[model samples]
Target: MAIGDILVDVQAVAKHYGDGETRVDALRQVDLQVRAGEVIALLGPSGSGKTTLLNIIGCILDPSSGRVMLDGEPVFDGKWLRSDLRRLRLDKIGFIFQAHNLLPFLTAAENVSLVLDLAGWPADKGKERARELLDYLEVGHRAGVKPALLSGGEAQRVAIARALANRPRIILADEPTAALDSKRAQLVMDLLRKLATEQEASILTVTHDEKIFDRFDRLIHLRDGRLVDE
Candidate 1:
């Protein structure tokens, strides 16, 4: 891809935990580039560092060595600027985890609006956006419902709406479909693909479900903490 098309670039990145005898190399000279409007899947077995790499790219963790560039701007250069990292993560990146992580007491709309509230969005605007997102995700009927009242698929859809609330440039999802049934998993993957194309966002998702593998624009494999295929 051309330089201008790249939204995320990871260059020779490495991560290590502990030191000496207890040290574990979580990543090894990993290089990856994600372009705008692309959906890439990171496939690997458990403990293969998929989540580690996702965390690094999402600015949730620091790499021991190497660089990261987001939208042509350097975000990591051997050291992380904590404040900048936090700001960029909120403004430019969205994250989804295995769990919906919704605040159980909050209504669906309220849960989605919380993210906008953190970004300093006006209350009315945030609420409007939240509703729009929920509607778009086909969860509008559950806007006033709490997580405890929604089905698994409905809850996941709300989580996705919240993730897209900020219109982030990139999205990092770790096992986003793990809790869903096959049909729901396919629905989620299809939504992700649609988001990539319609929103022009780069998405990197880590998943072990081979059934949904064909939904991705590209597949990346990790083994022994290293990227073995792209």
Candidate 2:
């Protein structure tokens, strides 16, 4: 798709748990659109459904009611449109977390290469792709090191590389800078913005880090399970 194309199209999505009296609404009529090359920060207080919305967009969780389109294809309409949700996620979406969830035993490069492996790329080609991502993220020098040996920033960089391994059109990051200091958080947001521009990818970052708020192209506010203007 072109750089200005809408990569994510979420229409009146709602997510609720339990029934009637016991029902708890996590999201209510949430509609969102993320264009390619855009960087947006999703902000909200605790229990405001930020993660729920992100998970729904990532296809990791299903919504109670809504329709979703990714890369111009309908993926969900109350039920998943594609039977192979895993394959859809691998092909179109990337995810990063606050914890920098890297494999304990694998080197940084291996962690990245694993995504390509899952996507059915040849092992050697996967490794080369991992190397390229690590180099682009400026973590190539530490690619052979285990996660335990890296600093928080370094590990998160590795995680970012892993997220980029499949050339995904959209990246959903949940509190990616929560564990970092102010300076590091700012740096990470800057990196994300640069990645969005250079890769022409859409990035929706769920964050409470006011320090890095200015780095985003736009800020999306979530309150009481609904989106609101700043």
Candidate 3:
């Protein structure tokens, strides 16, 4: 991808936990670049640093060394600037996890609206945006339903709508379809790919499910905390 197309750039990044004898290298000189409108799958076995790398990219964790750039701006340079990093995570990055992690008490629209609220959007505007996202995700009818009332697929779609609530440029998903059946997993992957194209968002998803590999624009392999040729 061209330099201008790059949404996220991780240059020779490394992460080490603890110190001295107890120190463990979670990542080693990992380099990755994700461009806009692309869906990339991060494939690796357990303890391969997939989650660690994703967390670093998502601004949830800082690398021990190297730099991370978002939209051509440095977000992490050895140390993460707390104020700026928090804002960047809220405004530019969206995250999805293995579980839906929805607020059980809130309705679908409300669950999505909560994110906009945290971003300082006005109440009326947040509610409107939430409804719009639900409608777009084909879950408008379930807007008033609570998490317990929605099916697994519907809840997952709502969770996706929530991730898109901030209109983030980059999305980091960790095993988003791990709990779903094969058919449901396919549906979720299809929706994610569609979102990447239609929303022009860059998505880096960490997944162990090989069944959904074909849905990604690229597959990045990680082994022993280092990126390997695919």
Candidate 4:
């Protein structure tokens, strides 16, 4: 993809759950976009709808009303535009979470390989791809170790490698550095920026850690489910 191409386009999105007393507005008329090779941080308070917006952009959650475009293709408009959201997510989107969520029984390389395996790659090919990614993320030395044996930061890199295995156009991370210390948090942020730059992938991360704010190219601040000026 071209570096400046719009990879993720969210238009006038709104999301709410329940009704009356139980009503909860998760997002409100939100308009967002992430260009290829750009890294953006989504910031908000506990109930400020950061994750909701991220989920909508990642196609993990449906908005009450909106249009969502992924890699220049409409994937959602009021409802799903594609019947196979799972396939869409796998092919076009990469997801990272607060926890590494790596399989305890699998080695770091195997964890990354599993994603490629599910995408119909041969086991041997998947292993090679995993190694390449681990090497790129500077975690090659720990490729053979299990998640339980790896340090917090090391395990996160494995998780990131898994996310990148498919070479997705968009990468959505939710509190990716929440579990890391200040130094490690900064390291992960730097790695993400590098990934976006070299891979030409749009990166959006939901973060509460203010210490890493300076690491992002742009910041989207949300308050009461609405975008607020920074």
Which candidate leads the pack in lDDT? Answer: 2
lDDT of 3 at 46: 95
Q: Write the per-residue lDDT of candidate 4 for residues 79-166, one digit (tens) a residue.
A: 8989999889888888898988999999999999999988889999999999999998889999999999998899888999999999
lDDT of 3 by residue, 1-230 (tens): 33238999999999999999999999999999888888999998999999999999998887999999986778888887556677788898888878889999999999999999999999999999999999988999999999999988889889999999998889999999998999999998998888887777899999999999999989999988999966
Please provide, for model 1 over 167-218, each residue's C-alpha lDDT reduced to its tens digit, 9 standing for 90 to 100: 9889999889999999999999999989888888999999989899999988
| Model 3 pairs whose backbones collide | none
TM-score of each: 0.96, 0.97, 0.95, 0.97
- As for candidate 1, its clashing pairs are none
State model 3's lDDT: 0.90
Q: Global lDDT of each model?
A: 0.91, 0.93, 0.90, 0.91
Model 2 lDDT per residue over 87-199, tens place:
99898899998999999899999999999999999999999999999998888999999999999999999999988899899999999999999988888888888888888
* By lDDT: ranked, best first: 2, 4, 1, 3
Higher-lDDT candidate of 2 and 3: 2
Q: In model 3, which regions exceed 4 Å deviation?
A: 1-4
Clashing pairs in 2: none
Lowest summed lDDT over 10 consecutive residues: which window, candidate 4? 53-62
Q: Against the correct fold, how does model 2 do in TM-score?
A: 0.97
Clash count list over all predictions: 0, 0, 0, 0
Total backbone clashes of candidate 3, pairs 3 or more residues apart or in separate chains: 0
**lDDT minimum window of 10 residues, candidate 1:** 1-10
